[model samples]
Target: MFGMADMDPTGGLWNWAASSSLSGERVQGALAGALERTVISLDAEGMDGAVLCDVYHVSGDFPTLIDVYLAPETIAETTAASAVAVRLEVEIILPDDSLNPTRYVLADPAGGLRHVHVDEVETDDGPERRHVRPCTGDDPACAAAPEDKAA
Candidate 1:
């Protein structure tokens, strides 16, 4: 369901998009992030729009360095850091028993991601987790599961 050539910006690298928000707050946040990171070659649309950047490989590869984060400071959160992996973050949000999965299309690195699919998953340790993987195309909300629909 994703079309390349139209999204891959770098021409050779993996294409990815951030997010567009209904509130437009995300648009401003993306712009601010680009500026803070000294991103000089941003798509024309991004200059005026906001992106819902959930995950980023901040270091591209850093140990304990958490290259990707859920709520990046650039987008405004309780903290400040670099953008990390967006893909992995989505998975952290997935449910363990729910077979329902979502799908997302990656935008060209040059154009940036427009929208994405993320699922929140619970963890045994402390909090919840989000993962950024391709969904199965049928996302049945956990509460909507037939077994629990009665509750």
Candidate 2:
């Protein structure tokens, strides 16, 4: 089971590109590469067996959300040892589908999850990229409406 202590420090990197103009495929590729490097670094630190990582995309709205799930113990241990250094150049792109807004849920072994909403809005300056506030239990945007559920 994972807890706050098990969360990846590099998690913020997930939002690093919250305000860029890249394609969803490109963003996914970049994240996958970063995650690969993280795994390799862990292996180099002789902690390969201590951790496992997975990267997958959830399609919804523009600015598709990519979820990176890592084994808990490895993150805590490797972070404490300062073994992984992750650097990323971030840019966000809209998903192919324009029907729904994108929301990414990153879940750990214990079922704990974090939600990230990526979206773009038209502004006087052109298009502005932003992350909607993290979803809460009462946030209608966080989940489908009651009618949606009934349907």
Reference-based lDDT, each prediction: 0.28, 0.35
Model 1's lDDT to the true fold?
A: 0.28
Mind giving the per-residue lDDT tens digits that candidate 1 earns over 54-111? 2222211111111121222224220121122232221111112233443333333233
Give a tens-digit lDDT track for model 2, residues 1-151. Answer: 2233345455422222223334444544444453444332222344443223322233223233332334343334223211111222322332211123554333322323344455656544343445545545356556642433564
TM-score of each: 0.21, 0.28
Q: Where does candidate 2 stray beyond 4 Å?
A: 1-85, 89-99, 105-113, 122-127, 144-151
**Residue 110 lDDT, candidate 2, scale 0-100:** 30
User: Which number leads on lDDT?
Assistant: 2
Give Cα distance to truth, residue 68, candidate 1, Å: 14
Count of backbone clashes, every candidate in sequence: 44, 5
